[model samples]
Target: MTYTAPITEQTFVLETVAGIGEIQQLPAYESATPDLVQAILVEAGKLASGVFAPLNRKGDTEGAKWNDGAVTLPAGFADAYRQYVEGGWGSLGADPVYGGQGMPFVLASAVQEQLTSANMAFSLCMMLTQGAIEALGAHASEDQKQEYLTKLISGEWTGTMNLTEPQAGSDVGALRSRAEPHADGSYRITGQKIFITWGEHDVADNIIHLVLARLPDAPGGTKGISLFIVPKILPDGSRNDLRCVSIEHKLGIHASPTCTMSYGDEGNCIGYLVGAENAGMRAMFTMMNHARINVGMQGVSVAERAYQHALAFSKERVQVKRIIEHPDVRRMLMTMKSTTEAIRALGYLNAAAVDRAHGESDTEAKREWQALADLLTPVTKGYATDMGVEMSSLAVQVFGGMGFIEETGAAQHLRDSRIAPIYEGTNGIQALDLVNRKLPQGRWKPLFADIRETIRALPGDGDLGAIKPYLDDGLAALENATVWLVGNHGDGFDDAAAGATPYLRMFGIVAGGWLLAKQALAASERLAAGEGDPAFLKAKIVTARFFAEQIVPQGTALLGPITRGGALLFALDEAQFAA
Candidate 1:
């Protein structure tokens, strides 16, 4: 089935979890007025629902064709790109000076979720362009910005992040790509970078490639790496010395080109440095923070898409007989619906934390929320994406044989979702970050206090008894994990990493349940006033309870090893069973 952008759920999430216009009350976020945000969302949704949603299945089936130096996207992509540009959706959250709409990243974050969920492959072009725009905005010289950011922001052109060399991968310091500095303050870049999304496409007049290379005298490892902007089209509209060497035949996200980019083959790949030479890592980080959050959004998007499809499929296609006159298929259908909604709540809460971190006026308040964002970012990226892929698989199962057929479109969601956990620094890395950095930061007491304080602020009325019990259970487990980390920090440091993946998942389930409950209460308030849909509001509360009853209970089981399981992993013999 073709995807329908979940506009109703998204609108509810924004008004409830994201709490629009609340941010506007702060001086730092004064620009995030509800009227402005609503207007931007409406315009952005037009592109997502009207332009991209219709083309999702077509793009997947047709994919992108690569030949020589050019890439031909699926038939409707170029038209959609033109529509995105016309609507200003491409640059909605970009820096203001570059002719972008200057919307809040938080506001755009949710909209991006809908677009990517509606169509991942197509949305990638816009996603990558945002990264390149940030790189240029943060580090590019005035001339570079004046010449590049404006058009890129206007969606007249596109951008790509070129960091993965065959040898480098995640180890940027191991890269062999060379950059020879010329007398004209430019470098002649040479070598190959692979997995470059939208490296070559027909929709834009120019493609800006932000690449990493090493200077001759530079120190070894990452210290030697430098960032450079190598455009596909020169300032004079001439060809630059970079070509799409070849595109990969991937298992998933077929519509997005993952090209092997070869630079300086003609010895004319002149590129300007951004920021200081060899400080490329720092500059790249600016783009990484933005990309990391956006990548997390991919998890949210796929999960929502998968959930909707599964729910729709379960309701219409009866599997087991009805139980007590109510269809048994309805029971399975409810599980998919409830699980998906819970995941959606988890994702939006993560975004809200990010926005609060950036917008809160209080320094201490900012630190607290920002730390919460840091803690959840990895969980959101790793757990949510994993859930998305799994959810898509379940949807296929629910659809039975028809779902396996290519024309049904359920399989593609699973395929596309598989890449998210592997990208944006991978789930393993996110897990490591969660354990090594986020878990032990600023001592555990402060984070514990923050949670307790938040719980204290929640409404203490009759309807919340269910939430209180769940929250208590979750909080108790969290405290146990916290105390173990703090008291035995060093004892477990060398032997606890094996459980990192489980640790993140445990975090996500409990935290997600909590967010779901909070959202339920907010929804109930609207329902009481006859403002929002009662089904939606009731759905929030029911799913949250189901999550607590069935899902949140797993954290207790996962705790035994997460704090001290590395010893077992290290204990495995190197040649136990060589395959």
Candidate 2:
């Protein structure tokens, strides 16, 4: 099935739920006019559907090949990447001082949704590079920025994050990589890094790796860790002391090479420190935070692709006058459609918060926006990814035996979606971060208040009135859960931790319901004014009502889990698990 970009739906979300008008009002983004945003979305849609989507099946089928430490992508992959570079797609929200287009990130996010929907694996390279650019922009030295940021922003070179090792996994502090000081003020990084995405690829001129290692005299654990810039090719055009030892044969995203890299094998891996010594985690979080949001978008992306694939199949497959005619099939389709839309709304809303956090000049306002962004980051990443997995599975079920087969391409979406929740920190980690770290900051107070205020302000008539009771119920459940988490967090940490996942799900469900309600209200006003397409607007209202009625109730259901504490979870011992 050919991928089609949902430009109209994306535009509606941006204009209605994401507050793009407020983003455009910011001084830095004054040039991001509605017309320009629309044009960019249109062009991005073409590239995503035309160039990228066609290669997705081929990439999955052929995968990437490795030979003697060299990696090669499937046919058309490199050419498609080259087209992506020539189109300046990577520079949309990049720094204008470094030859970027300097548009708002929300627009870039919409573009990313389309690209990811088209080809999840191929889009990863760009996503990682964008993260690297942000990290370097925040912490890299002037010389380092000049050497790296320009090329990265231009898409002339791609980037990778090397934190996981054979043993380190998610415990970054456990990494054994060593960095030795050199007479030239650079360092020699020596270690083996594993699970590095796009770490070794022939599609770009060079691969810039952001590696985390430790110094000999530094303290133990994470406090001693430092980040380094280790490139495949040095400035003088000589090969750096790094090589892709091997590429992983994985369950999904086969097109994206996950590499085992050996650095300083020849004892000459020249590297420059980012930020300060032993401050690697601080700098790396910059990249990780950026990546986490995009990973969430990946969840939305795969879900959309799976939904489209299943919807198309339902229309054509004739099992008693087309499966689309069946009520059960229609229910599944509606579930996929409403959930995907909810996730997309959450992702875009999060991106807008990022834009506001950065663009706001007032100190207090910036802090509030930043806090909101922090609170939503894990929810966006965790909830969306979990739902991505669920939606893909539903899509597979929709296709029955064909979904399990390779030719139908329905399974690919399922396979490709399985990684989002695992990477950029696991969904479990996101939950812990939410309840343990973010909730304690008390930022949720204003945010929760705003949700209540927004719900209260919404019109209580017709479709809006139908959704209000569900919204109120969901919000009440979310508030009670939040109180339970906070109260238990200090005296009963394990209790709070156990309930984190459920609490996060509740937050996402309620937040998503709120945004969709807002969208429905906007669509209603537009319909009354004859300002937009009636069919689309009415559909928006219906989707909102569906989500509120069907999905929002789950928030209330999760209240039990969110308040249940760790007694049952830890009651079973290690042997009991096996038993």
Please provide TM-scores, in order, for all candidate models, with all chains considered together: 0.93, 0.99
lDDT of candidates 1 onward, in order: 0.77, 0.92
Candidate 1 ranges with C-alpha deviation above 4 Å? 27-31, 319-332, 360-366, 443-447, 453-463, 486-491
Model 2, which residues run further than 4 Å from truth? none
In the range 426-488, model 2's lDDT, one tens digit per residue, is 999999999999999999999888788868977778888899999999999998999899999
What is the lDDT, from 0 to 100, of the residue 415 in candidate 2?
A: 94
lDDT of 1 by residue, 367-471 (tens): 887887777778777788777777777777767798898777888888998888887688888887877787778534665565565466556655454666666
Error of 1 at 394 (Å): 1.6
